[model samples]
Each structure stands twice: as structure tokens, then as C-alpha cells.
Target: MQRLTQLITCLLGTLLFGAAAAADAILPKPFTATYEVTYRGMRAGQITFKLTRDDATGRYTYETTADPSFLARIVISNAAVERSVMEIGPNGVRPLEWSLDDGKPGTARDGQLQFDWNKKLVTGVIEGEKIELPLEPGLQDRLSIQIDVVTSLLRGEEPGLIPLIDDNRVKRYSYVKKETTSIDTKLGKLDAIVYESTRQGSSRQSRFWLVPDREYLAARAEQIRKGKVETVMVLQSVQ
Candidate 1:
């Protein structure tokens, strides 16, 4: 059979060139994330992001949880840099690498997280340097951490580069609205786009509930600030 049609056309051209060189790392595979943030009313704390994606180098592994006994008082608990993030690229977030809780070893105060994809804005750096956050113009009604929708959920179009693992420290924002959305539970539903300055603002409507033919993004909905009260988060399983 012509050598099985040239070995099935070389396995379909090596799976379409590995899915176009991984179209930016293809959503980081394995999923299971839940975040419920609120303001102006109270319940302003809840985070759970457990990720894993390493299908032969797509590379990614996260673990963030909240309410570790609410950590003491005034509601400013470090939660150890949101349980020490580490997303290397697809945007960038390198917050901590060691000593947490008491903070100190590298002192990453847990602040400043500037993102601005495409146009390339990239912020947040500790120990190695660069950190100056303090910008708000459209979003951010004092979100403790969800920084404009969590790096628009690990974007990818250029070899998966969106990992900001904190460095240098102390940045109090200056501007952010570069698009961010997520509602994925092992590809069930809810998927919005945009992540870093798509010209400028106005495009933050989200709704999710996938699975019709899924692979990721579980449940999502965001909007309604100012007076607060609009929020939707679902996705209770992923591995």
C-alpha cells in the first residue's frame, strides 16, 4: 500500500507540525482553576488554581489556594505570593522561588504585576530586578489578586511566553486592562479572549460553559463592577 501511504503521510505531517508549533503552547493543557473575587460587599477572598501542562515541553505547573485559615488579620495575608506562582511564559509571572509566609528571603512583598501582551509591556521582577506597579484605567476596582483576569489565561501565539514569576519586587501598578478571561475545567466551557493592550479597552464581556466539543475552559462570567454583584465561577474537577 505504497508503504502505508508513506506511513500515513508521516503521521499527518507530524500532527500538523505539532499543531503549528503549539499555537503558543495550546492553553497549557491540564486544567482545574476556580477563582471567586468580590468587592464592596465582603467575601473578597477565594482562589484556587491547580494547573499542569507538560506534554513534552509545553511546560507549566501551578498550585494556588486560599483561606489557609485566612492567615491572621486585616485581610492582607500574603498567602505566600498567591501560593508562589510560576508561569514562565505565555505572558510571564515568576513571583517567588523560595522562603514565603514570613517573607524575607528575596522579599517579594507581593505587589506589582504589570502585563501588556503583543505590544510587549511585561512587568514584575524580584531579586533579579524590575518592579514598578501602579496603573488602573478601566479595570481593577482594588482587586487583591486576579490582576485583570489572570494574564488573560495563559495566552499563546508565539511559542508560549507568558510567565511573570515576581522579581525585584515593590511595584504598585500604573495601568492595566490588557484583556484577561478564564472558565476552563479540562475544556468544559467559557472562553473569552484578549490579554495585553488590544489598542485600548472596551471588550470585557465574558460567558462560559463549554463541553459541546471541548478540551478546556470550564465556567466563567465577569462584569458588573461599580456597584458590584456580577460574578460566576464554576469548575469543580480537573486533573
Candidate 2:
């Protein structure tokens, strides 16, 4: 009877440990996804997004590269890149650094930001100007904000106002959960949850169709201004 009791206790401990491990594995596995970009109903460009992690440091790097078509290049860039490096902790995902390149050499649109949590400040250079802004809890960079939304949805929580550093200023965008619907994509049909995000005091709205099965990745995204669609992106492939 004593041996049997010890075995049962050990089994129970193992089960609890397994449950904790599963809970900690909520984040999506690293992946590379590509999308077809459109502007005003015309084929414009392609975007490749990548998410990678450093197991040793528990840090993540999310990057997006945009290659525009010749016509699109007139409005956009030949090649643009945005990257965010962040870490997840008790307070949530915190961005340590972020950088953007508009693909124009010596252009003013290229900049980078460094976050200092200990000092509660974010310092960066934007458009040939220096910036130093006070940091608030739950602050995020442009790329990290997407991960924050995905993390919140996976945890069964509503994604509230996202405070992110844009350019040289902090902007707040509120996300509103809409509906669950089926969307046709290059990979086939998928069920996705629709979300609309609007910047405070702005008429421009962004919409996302996130597939839960794909780790809440956006299968389709659009930008609307005054009820007119300005830009759209559809998932083309993932690996």
C-alpha cells in the first residue's frame, strides 16, 4: 500500500507538470508567411513576414519585408523592411528594439528605436530628429503590437487599446472583435475571426481576418479610409 501511494503521487505530479508545459506553449511556432499586396484593387507588391525565437535568451524577432512592383514603387518603396525584437514576461511582451527602412538610401524615413524599461523611456531617431519619450506600461512597437493582439486572443482576452510608438510619437489604436467567417485564401478556405482597429480620432480603419488554427495569424488584411478600401493583403503561403 505504501508503494502504491507513492506511485500515485508521482503520477499526479507528472500530470500537473504536463499541464503547465502546455499552458506555457501558447505562443505559435516560428514561421515564415508571405502575402500578396494590393493597392486600390490593383496588384501592388508582395510581403514576407518571419517570426523567429532565440531559445537561449527567450527573445523573439518579428520581421516584414515588402517588395513593391514598379507601379507600386511610385507610391511605396522598392523594398521596405520593418523589424522588432521583443521578449515575453510576466508583464507581457516588451519590445527591446525596433527599426524600419523605407528602402530609399539616405532617406529620412529610416529610423530605429531602443526601449529602456528600467529607465521607463524610449529613445529613437526618426526623420533626422531625435526622440525621447516616457514609457508606459504595455507599450509596444509597430511589429510587436501584432503579436500582442495575437497573444491576447489566444489567452481568451479582448485586445484593448494598443499603445505603440509610430514615427516619433505614441499612438493608440483600439481593436474591436467583429465576427467569425469563412475566407478563401491561396491555401484554401479557412475560418477566421475578423477584427477592426481604428486609431483614436482617425477616420482610417484597418481590418484583419485572423485564423485561429494558424496561431491567429492574419489571413487577410485591409485598410479603409472613409469607407473606401485603400490597401489589401491576402495570405499567399506559409511555412
Q: Best candidate per lDDT, number? A: 2
Report every candidate's CA lDDT. Answer: 0.32, 0.71
Off by over 4 Å in 2: 1-21
lDDT of 2 by residue, 6-39 (tens): 1111111000000123466446457777777777
The digit string of per-residue lDDT tens for model 1 on 1-239 reads 12211111111100000111236433334444554543323443554555554567644445444432242224434343332233344333332222123223435343334444333333554333554443322212112123223333333122122221223322222222334454445444344432221111323232333221233233433333233434334344443
* Candidate 2 worst ten-residue window by lDDT: 10-19
For TM-score, the strongest prediction is 2
Residue pairs in clash, model 2: none
Candidate 2 overall Cα lDDT vs. reference?
Answer: 0.71
Error of 2 at 234 (Å): 0.3
Which residue runs does candidate 1 get wrong by more than 4 Å? 1-65, 69-108, 115-165, 168-215, 218-234, 237-239
